[model samples]
Target: MAEEVEARTLSRVAWRFIPFLILCYFVAYLDRVNVGFAKLTMDTDLGLSDTAFGFGAGVFFLAYFLFEVPSNIIMDKVGARRWIARIMLSWGIVSGSMAFIPEIASAIGLSAEHTFYLLRVLLGFAEAGFFPGIIFFLTLWFPASHRARIVGYFMAAIPLSSAIGSPVSAALLGLDGAWGFRGWRWLFIVEAFPSIVLGFVTFFYLTDRPADATWLDPQARAWLQRRLALEDRRREHVSPSSALASLADHRVLALSLVYFGAVACNYGISFWLPTIIKGFGLSIAMTGWVNAVPYVVGFFGMIWWGLRSDREGERTMHLAIALALAAIGVGGSAFLADPTTKMIALTIGAFGVFASLPIFWTLPTAFLAGSAVAPGIAAINSIGNLSGYFGPFVIGWIKDATGGFLWGLVTIAACAVVALAITLALGHDPHLERAPEAAE
Candidate 1:
């Protein structure tokens, strides 16, 4: 009877929430990374060298780093529904405004490069809390035992964005001269539209907590509330007392380092993969389709690895293995000159890179609960995302200096190796995940 209730309640929650959240994140990630696609031509238009483009691209995260913790704490105070909606609306406006860099630069008497940097900064500030906020919000709805798989499903939007968004973005590039706007500009306008529309819909559609989830039948609601409460009670015994203290917790700092390595690998590839593929002598559209291949592999890897970790009730080893694979694949890609072999290596790296993400998140949520969750997750996300700046900047600088991507790939691989070491050393406690009823 308990098993049946668990199944029914979780299923309803998953169905009710995951799909729509995925859609929201899909558009969010597309808007964030679509600049990679735009860089194909925007570089030429703006007279940006590779290093300048990378620095401009990475500036987004600097703003994201500055604002993420406060934004998340604010979301916790105001409720995810209101704060998240506001975040979406603001970012959507900023993201679409990316289409007008030249005109905005002219009006403000700034160069286009500075305009690019300014817009990226705004986009980062607007989107600051969205990811960690979602992670914290999930802990409110689901138990730790179920989180790896649940987070896997939620974060699948990352790879899915690249998989599907790649082709669509590439195709949009075909509109180069349509209506007197560049195709990249059209891409920004069209993609930003969904986020704005969805921002309004999120308020009406999302319930803040199980206690407030009136969409469920009474029995399911009671079961969910009780189950979640039990988990929260168990967590109270382990978590830090306040959000501020969580920022200084040893585990939090360690996890931040682990996440930094992973983010380096993720953004390093995401920002540059299109450029790498284009160098293969393919046209813009073909480059988009090819870029989708690794991400498609990564999408499945993320889901499967998350499920496997949950079933095995292991976190550290699972994360370590995935990071090891990422290090090997990304490092190997550096030495290969053939596009086919190089792509094979990158695809394997993509699987490892993405698979590690959901599993890595389980470590923090395993122990953090109540007030600690919001700031802890936010701090880790903010610090970790600093790599979003360094990774792309280093890669672009390397490409400029060496006239190739070899050393850039090697640098990301080294970052992954560092992450793997950290994960193995942390050593998670599976006991923290048990429900109060189960423990008793």
Candidate 2:
């Protein structure tokens, strides 16, 4: 009877939340990285070099890192539903405004380059806390045993955005001359509209917590609340209660380093993958399709790896192995000259790059609870995302100097190796997953 109730309650909650959240993140991620696709043509229009584009693309993370912790704190205080809706609405407006960079720059008497940097900074500011906020929000509903897979399902949006959005964004590029705007301009305006619309939908659609889930039967609601509360109690018993203090914890810092490595590889490749594929002499449309290859592989890898981690009740080895694979694949891609062989290697690297993420998140949430959850997650995310700045900037800088992407790929691969070592050293305690028997 207990097992049946648990299954039914979790299933209901998953159905209610996961699909909608995936749609939200799918659009969110697309807006964030579609700039990559834009770079193919936007560079010539804006007079941006590889270095300029990289710096502009990367500066978003600087703003993201600065505001992330505070944003998460505010979400904790206000409520995820309203705050997240606000984030989406604001970012949508800013993201759409990206279409008008030249006009805005002309109006302000600034170069288009400066205007690009400024808007990306604002977009980052508006989108801050969104990802960590969602992570913290999930813990309020799901148990530790369920988190890796749930996070996997949610984060699958990252690759899904690139996979589907790649071809779509490429296709939209064909609309270059429409309404006197360039194709990349159309890309920004059309893609950003969904976020603005979904922001409104999210407000009415989301329930802040399970206790307020009137859509659920009373029995299922009660079961979910009891289960979640019991798990919170178990976590609170050993974890730090103060958010500020938890930021100083060793585990948090170590995990941030591990994430830094993973994110470095992620953003570095994300910002440059289109350029890499375009060098193969493919048309813009073909570049979009081919660039999606790795992400398609990553999409499946993320889901399968997260499920395997949860099923086996393991964290450290899973994370370590993924990082190791990422290092090898990325490093190998740097040397392979053939487009086919290079893409095959990059696809393998993408598998490791994405597979490490959902499992990595499970580590911190396993221990951090109560007041610590928001800031702790935010700090790790903010600190780790600093690599987002360095990753692209470094890749761009190296490309300008070496006239190729060879060393850039190697640099990110080294970061992954460092992360693999740290994962082994920091490790994880599965005992934290246990809940008090009374709730069951």
Global lDDT scores for all candidate models: 0.92, 0.93
Candidate 2 is scored at a TM of 0.98
Clash count, predicted structure 1:
0
Candidate 2 C-alpha error for residue 285, in Å: 0.8
Q: Which runs in model 1 stand beyond 4 Å of their true positions?
A: none
Per-candidate clash tally: 0, 1
Model 2 ranges off by over 4 Å: 438-440
Error of 2 at 198 (Å): 0.4
> What TM-scores do the predictions have?
0.98, 0.98
Clashing pairs in 1: none
